[model samples]
Target: MGDIENIDNLLALEALLQVTFHNRSLLLRAITHHSCCSETALRDSYDTLEFLGDAIISAHVVEYIYRSFPNASEGDMTALKSEVVSRRVFALIGQQLGLFPFIRVDIANLRTFNERSRDSLCADVLEALVGAIHIDQGAEVARDFVARAILPMVEQVSVQADTNPKGRLQKIILQRTGSLPRYRVLEQSGRNNDRIFLVGVYDQETLLGLGKASSIKEAGRLAAREALETLQKQRGKASIIDVGDESQPQL
Candidate 1:
């Protein structure tokens, strides 16, 4: 879909977000991407608000983790907050909220979102919306918006902390090697929205494992699990998995 002709046509969006902007222009700008705006444009885009929103979201997520899981160790809390309080989660929430349709983006760039992305434009809009709400409605309302939109994801993250392959692999890697695993997209194929991603999991200079899936995150999970299995099997047979001297693969 193409960018809309007018900014005031956001009543339905307000209803969906359960937030009415007294200054409707703020809401308008919150959804406007720079690609659809120009140097001579009179109005600003979501970039500034996104910066403020990032801080707000991080603080709230940290506070939530601290207050909700009192029994959790500091390490666990920090890990959860660091891994789960991310742009991916925010983008997923934005998709769930049906916010993409209202975003003011160049039509040419609209289809780019079909691929799996770690840092998504939808996240920017989501954060900008939070910033707008904070500006127009105040802290309480912004917190409420986050509570309604983002808080639910925290429990899922906590529950999956040990079970998810990527998180589990990360913890194990850190304990064993003192280095986190990095994932890089290796390949992509397929048509339009049905594209597949091949991701490789690497430990510093060593290629741990590779996995392919419909999305980058899923591919990363598979790669992580493969790496974990490889580590386990290698440990079972011998103490260490040898990494011969070879040039590092640039990710």
Candidate 2:
């Protein structure tokens, strides 16, 4: 079974988070995935720690935003907190921390999962680490750790949160043309495990773009992104044409 000695990465992470653990075993337990211990019959894993850490992280983030942005309304702060604590944002943070390098996973078939899977795993580890920190130290220490490690990345997270292609296209259409973008299911196919959906985006009576994905939501987002790109290109060309026409001599 793996012990604190097996976790060389913890030392580096300790330096990064700027907090030393009183109980090194707790930190090791925090990073230990169920898969790792399942094979060795080890009782401790990070799942419970992850659950606790998630709650602590949420509370810490909300309180930080609430105090920092006092002039901002509750709804805005809530929206910001939701984005900040999102899985996607946390996964990005994990990637930045190089958490993947420290993860202990099965060596076989590891190459097949791709970067997305690795990112998801790393994100989970980060949450578990937070839980471990809370347990080893206290709520205040965990809060400070989160504030130091995560708060600096809030601006980046906010930018990415707003870049959801579907939402972006919807907002642009509504603001520019005073109309909401619409979606239609073009087709769906395949079985439960590997289903595919094709969807199209429309503006009023006109079809803007079409796309396909494993899920209807993803297909719709893809279609919206395509439409947004097309719209932007058309606008750019129109502007260029207008400028050219203006620059030409009157005949």
Candidate 3:
């Protein structure tokens, strides 16, 4: 709710993060915002740590994706990374960890800002905390922090991917033929901002499915869903739909 400058506050934060800071000043600085600090005292802010934490989180995320998804392509890994390191994801993590209350901000500015702005601020503070942890301890400790706070979300991501039509189709195609399904835009029409895209999905030489949507991604997903349904009809018993009971959203 206020500046986390006191010993008790720092200790509580340490408990929350499950890491004991050798240099407590780093922890204090990580929770302080520049808006709340004077020019002369700006060094007390979390800015520097935020910068460092961005790199720290990114490196760990890339490593995590590479090792966890051994079969995933570079593009796939990158897509997962983008989702994991996204501001929205970080903001959700930050909120869950109660980082917002500890952040020291200019009350006037904070009051004027909207929910989106506050979420961005919370995400920044979360990154700064990661930076501080890295500086105060090391990569191993920072990794522990990430595992505790961020990696749990990886499971959720997996579940989302599992229920995704495109993800399901990719896994099925890859397992059945050891080749990924390809989606190509057959035609695009309408205005630039509100354009329509017709996409076709192929497995090797066969056109498995076709779909039309406003965006390339949506069209691809729809095509994948259609492909899955088609495959199910052809195979009868052995189909991707029978692979799991996970409910997929309609693309």
lDDT tens per residue, model 1, 116-208: 532376788889899999999999999999898988888987876533578778888899899999999999999867789999999897999
Ranking by TM-score: 2, 1, 3
**lDDT value, residue 95 of candidate 2:** 87
The 10 consecutive residues of candidate 2 with the worst lDDT sum are 107-116
lDDT for predicted candidate 2 compared with the true structure? 0.78
The models' CA-based lDDT, in order, is 0.81, 0.78, 0.82
Tell how far residue 165 is off in model 2, in angstroms. 5.9
Ranking by lDDT: 3, 1, 2
Q: Model 2: per-residue lDDT, tens digit, 107-209?
A: 4634445555676788788898888888889888888888877876666655554436776788888987899999999898976556789999998978888
The best candidate by lDDT is 3
For model 3, residues 131-221, the per-residue Cα lDDT tens digits are 9998889889999999889877766876566235788798899999999999999999976545789999999989999989767886887
Is candidate 2 or 3 superior in lDDT? Answer: 3
Q: Give me the runs in candidate 3 sitting further than 4 Å from their true place.
A: 1-5, 162-251
